[model samples]
Target: MKTKIILVIIIVLCTFFIGMMLFIKYYSPKEKSNQLLSNVSVVDGKQIISITAKGGYFPRITNAKADIPTTIKLNTKATFDCSSAIVIPGINYRSYLPPSGETIIDIPSQKAGSSMNGTCSMGMYGFVINFN
Candidate 1:
């Protein structure tokens, strides 16, 4: 019947639109831009990376050297958001940062062409450190 065919067509279009929306939301180039303050440095053979946590982690992307002991200095100034708590699954490091201070986290030397990811407690904010 004509009505049945039209209903089927509408259902197909709706399904396709929903699928595309989900794809774009979950698998897009949202993280392609690097933040301005990567703040990565090396001293005494130790790599130190700094990140500011407020509404989100600044410098969403950072490039650093591999095969060196690393430390992450998370700075939070009057941060009362979910970003105050961070999780680094690569090192099994999870902690709640003070509302206004710096927290240091250590990471072992990583192989070249590897990456480390950190996210807020609710997984809403995040950052990435690429070692190469």
Candidate 2:
């Protein structure tokens, strides 16, 4: 019957739409953040870099001053993904971040033109900090 065929087509279309939505939500690349300028600050002569880690690290790229003692803060709120497992190979740092809190790692003063990179445990998500 035409009615039956139409109903089947509708159901198939709905299913396809839902599947695509789910894939885009969890499997698609992360959106870039526009908070780069606000994420870095100097407090009492020490540089502080703030990054939010949820589905992935935000701001993807951070710019900061070099040759200053620095602390990188990884903030998380209800993060249950691989991004919580942060790894910074340059400093030999690796750890599992809490689900809802902040993790701070001290970084020594870096020479200008150097950079540091952090990635999730699975290496599926990452971010970079450039010193200038």
What are the per-residue Cα lDDT tens digits for candidate 2 across 1-132? Answer: 999999999999999999999988766534323334679999999999999999999979999999999999999999999999999999999999999998999999999999999999999999999999
What residue pairs clash in candidate 2, if any at all?
none
The list of candidate 2 runs beyond 4 A from truth reads: 1-36
TM-scores of all models?
0.71, 0.73
Tens-digit lDDT string for candidate 1 (1-132)? 999999999999999999999888766644432234448989898999999999999878888899999999999999999999899999888999999999998889889999999999889999999999
- Name the best candidate (by lDDT): 2
Q: Tell how far residue 111 is off in model 2, in angstroms.
A: 0.9
In order, the Cα lDDT scores of the candidates are 0.90, 0.93
User: Could you tell me how far off, in angstroms, the CA of residue 112 lies in candidate 1 after the best superposition?
Assistant: 0.8
Q: Please give the lDDT score for candidate 1.
A: 0.90
Best by TM-score: 2
